[model samples]
Target: MPSTDFQESSSSPSSFNLSILSRRRDQVHSMDSPPLESNGQQSDLEAFQRTVAERFQDLAAAPSEELLSIPWIRKLLDTFLCVHEEFRLIVFNHKSSLAKPPMDKYITDFFERSVKALDVCNAIRDGIEQIRHWQKQLEIVLCALDNQRSIGEGQFRRAKKALIDLTIAMLDERDSNTTVSHRNRSFGRQSNSRAEPRSMANFRSLSWSVSRTWSAARQLQAISSNLAPPRGNEISATNGLNVGVFTMSYVLLFVMWALVAAIPCQDRGLPTHLFTRQFAWAAPIGSLYERIMEESKRRDRRNTCGLMREIYEIEKCVRLMNELTDCVEFPLTEERERQVKQRVQEIGKIYEAIKEGLDPLERLVREVFRRIVRSRTEGLDSIARANLQD
Candidate 1:
């Protein structure tokens, strides 16, 4: 019954536009699910990348006035293990004492801060010691807790033994006392029957009250045994938890320090330009430093290889992402930002991969390092002497 002229044609652009919008929404939803790159691993990588990259840029863009001391909170418990952590502080900590060289990239504060006794490594040294020192302190507290629990247990045992002795004495007293009381009652009953004796009820009631008192004492003892004491096992258990804290904190730091010490690569310093130049000369991978990095990434480690691998993977991804950003002269934009975001995701993936890979590597690295360090030091010293003689 509809008029043909009034009917809107299905082929027209207006009707077709609604179909397109629905399709677009569906497309976005498909991308919205976690990426297969590692669920959200890639995203985490991208986030880390952006943070570091932005910090780098900020440092670069900072005015001479602003660049004096980095505002970043460098509370890296992990950073203390870095090969360059102590060195960088040592180099920068002396900024104020240097000859009138004003071409220094140091924010004036860096030099000013460095003047007091030149203990650039002091902070890192303190941090490392504290991590271990706190561990030892935790161990002491745990020992104290354990000792306290032992004393408490000794007290409980003593109480239980005393209760047993008291119960046995009470039972013996009751048995002998009952015999005596029974005899007396019998005599009294006989005397009462002969005299005015229908009133034995009061004595019988007193006997019942004594029996009830004995039952109550027994119940009280049972309840005391069953109820939990205020500090039973708790102190020891807390001390037990300290064992975990010690292990976790020590293991993480040990793994971190071992990584820095054993690795062939060094941080050199924050002189990115100077390093970049040296790195450029190291090999032609556009950066000589990059080539040494690739070589170092492939090094042999005993058990801790996995840990090293994980660290290296994160390091590699970071290096690559930084390199990409550096080479890109393009202006930052939404699309570029999205690309950066993708890089962050990759970094996250690398982080997880490294973590997953740490345990085996740690064991192997320690064993091998101990042997190598033991044997190589004297030989290396002799070789240096020989080279000097030559």
Candidate 2:
């Protein structure tokens, strides 16, 4: 009877627990279920707040000397800060040089945009809580740079045409101001000079030179046209390859000369209204052009450093995790192992996401830089030809 009672007790224990489980199964199910949306978000927010607070405290507690003792982090900070400082100087100096109304307006606009970009850099350099804001700012700055390039090109072209027109008008005025008697005397002198064989020789030499040049040009054209035609796909693929660079650099060269023309004329006691009008027209465009170039370069550098910054942060996280590993009790437990694995996986995913986001932005900047280089190459070629002719 005692053996029977022991067997029944052992068997009844399992059934009793099973009944309890069945009775409270709904309670267990509810506990296992995901929290309500609001509760989940609130919990997440609280966790994030706690994490951010802890991060801030940790960052504050870390000695600058110790942080800087880490070679890579020091180098990263130095390079980032130095580049941004240079960018700041460039923008400020450019803004200070601005003079006329339109120029002031454009400079202000560009300066504002540049400041926004710089703000992003500063935030990243300072190790802010949120990175997404700066990422968007970087994109905004890129768009602004592109827009500045386009508008600057347009303004420069207009100013160039206007300057050309003004120069022609001035020449016409100079000609009209000359007396008919002076013209007659000049014509008479020219008629008398025409009797000389030197003039005829000179004229013949000029004609021969012209004919030679024409023949050479024709031969070059024929050679080009006779070559196998490029496929439509090939041509289309390469068509806009250097558009941004060519557009900017083309007007850039012309803008330099226009600025030169405006400067001395206004300084040499020419009518203020005459030259200042054009100077005012062009000054804004020049500032915009410089701003575009500076900002584009800044954007490129920032985009490159962005990935490095993420890596730095990830390293910090990893270092902290490594430090805590020894402190964790029961490090061989399945739960602990799972948590570590999950964390490592999360860090890896974060790294991958950062890399993926930056790759496209870097590619875009690289393409722009390539276009600029191509434009520079063409400019050099043209300069070489001009020098040869001279």
Candidate 3:
């Protein structure tokens, strides 16, 4: 179980960092200047902040048991999509400001971060494909042992072979030197030679799939680099739009970091420090991050392929079934038969969970990939148009 501290912090709104709010208020009162933007613009910026905070708060408040489950990850992606659309509208309303000095710099930086995220999306899709392979092995095991008239030597042999193959595949994934990405084909490409040219062109346009040596940790670090909040003067100069850009940048970094933590990807490493406490949304996001870190550090999960709860359950089921098979005798005693049946039941439950969850989860990931691509193209075009008007 994750530490109880996260649950405690998330349950109460007062647990959020209030010092930042107080400090901002003090700074405002001390300034000789008037309000930074008109009341209307200020309202829009405040609404954006509130929406981000509310969405993350709901995510943080999830029961501990559901924290890293498939459904939870889907919810996380859904939150990102909603916030991203709102951010897009914010940018559209103030598109003219995007091409001006510091604002231009911020938007450019964000677009670059989005490009890096494209690679992360590709890596995550590969991880999903790897899980599907594991599922196939699970199915084989189920076929051998499930719905049998009576347990027999031949069935045990088949189950044992499937289990061994599954173990080998998982171990290979844990070895940092080996990764699914090495053999990964792009999501945009077809295997057919006739479609190769067009598919290759589309693949290149969506960001080329990451190479064998590319590290997810390094890519995340690149996104996080120099991602500082806008200064008060810059915020004022941009009519509060700089705050929106900063918010989206932080959101982008955190979402990508969480996806890597939850999915099996090449060279996965969690950044030690990723969030600041100054933002309204930071409290909940930080708590979720800490809890996930705690999960990864657990004794049994330390070297697993991924921190996803379904993966953990699968690993557990495999270990138990393997042990039961090893010690069982032919013409099994009633007690031994009972144990085998019990373990089979457990496996059946996990198998169903994976079957129901994986497809929806993959669809959500695909949607995320498309959303990022679309958002980047539209934002860049908007900025280009704004630049032309100048």
What are the TM-scores, per candidate, against the unseen true structure?
0.17, 0.22, 0.86
Give candidate 1 regions above 4 Å deviation: 1-262, 265-312, 323-332, 366-390
- Residue 69's C-alpha lDDT in candidate 3? 89
Q: What are the lDDT figures for the candidates, one per model?
A: 0.28, 0.29, 0.76
- Residue 113, candidate 3: how far off, in angstroms? 0.3
Better of 2 and 3 by TM-score: 3
Of candidates 3 and 1, the better by lDDT: 3
Number of the top-ranking candidate, with TM-score as the measure: 3
Cα lDDT for residue 338, candidate 3: 85
Residue runs of model 2 more than 4 Å from their true location after superposition = 1-308, 328-331, 354-369, 384-390
Candidate 1 TM-score, true structure as reference: 0.17
Local accuracy of candidate 2 as per-residue lDDT tens digits, 18-135: 1111223334345674332233333432333232223222332334333312232233233323333332332233322222233333333332332222222222222221233233
Q: Rank all candidate structures by their lDDT, best first, as comma-separated numbers.
A: 3, 2, 1
Candidate 2: C-alpha lDDT: 0.29
lDDT of 3 by residue, 128-149 (tens): 7778878889898889888987
Backbone atom clashes (below 3 Å) for every candidate:
32, 0, 0
